[model samples]
Target: MSDPVLVIGAGVAGMTAAVELADNGVQVVLVDRKSTIGGNALNLYKAFPTDDCFYCFEGNRWRPGIRKCFYRSAMIDQPNIELMTNTIIQDISGTPSKFTVKLVIGPQYVDPKKCIMCGLCVEVSEAFALESPQCQPQAVTYDPSKLDEGAKKAEQDCPTKAISLDANPSEKTITVSDIVLATGYHEMQPVAVDEYGYGVLQNVITQLELARILDPNGPLGGRLVRPSDGREAKRIMMIQCVGSRDENYYPFCSKICCVFALKHANIIANERADGRVSVVYMDIRTYDRHERYYREAREAGVEFVRGRISRVVSTEDDTLEITVYDSLLDKYLRFSIDLLVLSSALEPPEGLDEIIKTLGLKTASGYVGPADAASEDEVVVGEHVYACGGVLGPAEIPESVNQARAVVSKILQGRK
Candidate 1:
């Protein structure tokens, strides 16, 4: 049998590539650093352009339905795929088609196979909690730092004997026929840009945080409330280009920020009661079919200000007073808002540099770049080594899926 193909990251792109390859009679080893597989998409409530659930996707030809969700997909049950969560690449060696990888797998406190999703463990201890209702492998996770008597009791009483407090991390070395880097992007926190008052201000949050706040399964249960105080955030302000398109940080356009900001704005203006949304941006780049989002947002009475935020001050009443220099109007404006959301830059995931260095891969603005810079195919980063999704740059779900398909095609064609 041919060696298994190693697909790293386990985000939408990685999962897509792995499932496609597995269905095509190829062995796949899917690995992710997180305890669950969804990555950033897990937190996203709705995808732009389509406005469907982030997990909703067109399943493979073998699936009964045309559409399926990540949580309910064959990711965990597929026989051709070996799923590894809480694992990271420690080292990479050998040639492209025959690379040896050392992986450090984190300790598994709760065994997913034995776990029955019973609430007993979670009810008994603060340390035991479900990562998400839709989390794949469907199990409650345990936090070692919060170990207490309650945790001990829950472990002892667990119906499936899934809890293992003394579990230790182990390492494994594997050889693969091909490597696909699907390590997704991370949202910049914008804490260093103190002018935006991100970390210092309680009500100021990033787009991802806002996404979570709007999620029905989130901590607030879809309530758009101020983080500082539990009051409803009726008047919300979003500042775009928090870290991108600026020489001080990442100079490239994130490509999707403007559309997603408009998405949130439309949601708030149309769905939420008495909610008002305004966006402050240097430029609104809604390329391709996403221009509809901008139009819809405007139709919903969402205000668009072409300007930059000059100052942000927090009031004692948990309101944020923002001073904006409207470049288009050539005047300064001040407004008090319930929330200040930052459309922060999408950056390469942490430890990506180490992976790039280990694999001797090329990079563009810290993201994995194509092997042949002059080539039109961006997925192929090296011989038998490819990349897709946010690892290549800031990419939307459709684009990421397409790239993953491209990688799959390349691999299959090579074998043929």
Candidate 2:
């Protein structure tokens, strides 16, 4: 068979490249190990303050539309783009100009085309006591752990028999002219740090966990509560840069965390009349366009403390005692709060090293493949192999999409 232009990852960058290449008159095959295309951003409950109330809605802010996600739906539906999900590239060989790809595609019992978004599968699974809160209702694969209590009952309850605990597919090999790798960054597990007592402290939560709590469709139904006690929290303290900008940890500042903390604080204060929230940070990097967001947050009465937190220890009353050296006041201070939120640093996602090795791609920082010789800091996209989005480096949605477009130009130009 003739070689098609291959794009690895179904994230915004990969999908965008696929559509752009197809539009430019190239046969393309977009491959992803995941069943869905949205990537890490899709796991997000809402787009900060823009998506109505993150804590109040499961469906999109405006209902069924591709714009609901950061990557629009139309990008995937493009005629020239062929999306292959639940598939991983097992091997790649030949020069960058032309290559062979061996892929392993797993089975998804529920065919996306055949299943309407009616959510009957969820209802049936729940009736059989095999429902998982962590599982997305729209997700193609069902978690077997959810069926542990009554696997027999759940099996009978499945009207479509679409729940597959074990679904394997035959491996196949194909050829491609070029490849684009765009696997994105991963969320750091706050529990790994250990200083904040993440796993031990029930009321202590990570920023992502806070997002889940604020999500109306989440396990907490949007009420900010103490995880251990299930009581609505009146006072919340968000600790910024928990794993970021430290000599011991990641020395660089995670750019978006400050704004995220400010946004979260503003949202919580606005929702609850008596809500008191404070953000503890060494420096606030509202450096450019984000300065306005910081200004608005201050105007909304959210407290920003310029201090470095020393420790977070639980008190006898189950409240968290936060110790910080307030640089502004030149004094040490302590605050007790019902909830302690850790603005954990983001890291590159798992399986990237293996993927890099499999594809013979270079890497740095123990996560993603390294950048080009011209630009040592940025991930280098070879003439025939391209990379875009967070896999290249940390960036917001706009920057991510822009990188994708740049890759498209590179690929098209190479073709000529």
Candidate 3:
């Protein structure tokens, strides 16, 4: 029997690849360890270059013809794609064309297949409802322990009898023609850059954390406040390349950090208006079309300084003192700030070792790559495995999408 192609890590890259293949008459099984589909992109408020909102509509109400990213349940409605969230790849065996992939799938207390999503479970018991009411793969979740009274009530209340505390996790084996690994990158390791006062300082946060704070639906409700004092961050200092480009961590430049820093500066400029945003970087990398965002940031009065932070210390007055050597000025500059955001490195995701061991794949700087990249995109890694997106390296949304499509194209061509 012909099995669906398996795409691991249901990030933008994986989801795009799965959709492309499935739309082109190929069955696909998209899996991610996270309960929701969107990966790092979900945390983002806007994308660079255009500074467009990632998912929700931020357009003018009078204007028509607007489009947004897939932050909702549209993917769950696709007939050709099977989305398995909260699932992990346990082991792999057999050839790529006829591979048996072992998966450890977590139990969805309410089976989406049987769930009508009438909210009766939520009415009966709010015990295990997902954080967001707008969560994807709509199903009422329940906890066995909390459901002592609520479980039986929800079970009876549910229109489709989808609520069940007896749903136990089980190992599932799937046979697939190919495996597409799109495991995305992780945030900068703050513990490595201790001098930056990341975990040490309350207001100091990684760029990813800033993205979460900037997100309208995030914990802070898109409010720009210092994590330490809960006061509006009127003054912010952004330190670039926390882990990336540093010899101790990832030496290579993480291409996305510069633009992201600028994006944050722009946000503070627009939102706080009187906000003082200072960006200190060894070198400003606004390559190609992204230069506009850099110019916009500068025009918005966001101060750009050429320097690397030497140390970040706390002050007696509940403020952060960031010390950086300005190579351009040939002097050290100190910035007293309410919040300091570090644009850290994009390291490889977790479970990379497991992927390499189980699949016999090659890795470069923690990214999944062929034994030789020059071989071509379509070449099977070990026997029938493929990798794309940030798994191969630091890639932004556009590049990841292109890479995903490229992988699908190669797979389709090989099928014929």
> Each model's C-alpha lDDT?
0.89, 0.69, 0.79
Can you write out model 1's per-residue Cα lDDT over 240-300, one digit (the tens) per residue?
9989998999999999899889889988999999999989988899999999998989999
After aligning candidate 2 to the native by TM-score, how far in Å is the CA of 274 from where it should be?
2.2
**Candidate 2 lDDT over residue span 1-416, tens digit each:** 34678888776577667767777788888887876666665545655434443223233234334343323343455667777877887888877777878888876645555433445555556422211232222334555446554444444555566555455586888778888777877667677778788889999888778877876666667888888888889899888888787656666676777777776787788877678898888888866777776887788787888887778888887888888788999889888889988988777667777767766667655445544656743434554777787776555555666777787787777677
User: CA lDDT of 159 in candidate 2?
Assistant: 59
Candidate 3 residue-wise lDDT, 36-93, digit = tens: 6778877777876556765653322332332344424446766889888889999888
State every prediction's TM-score relative to the real structure. 0.97, 0.84, 0.88
Candidate 2: segments with Cα more than 4 A from true spot: 48-72, 124-140, 149-157, 164-166, 358-380
Q: Which prediction has the highest TM-score against the true structure?
A: 1
Q: Cα deviation of 162 in candidate 1 (Å)? A: 0.7
Compare candidates 2 and 3 on TM-score and give the better one: 3
Cα-based lDDT at residue 258, candidate 2:
77
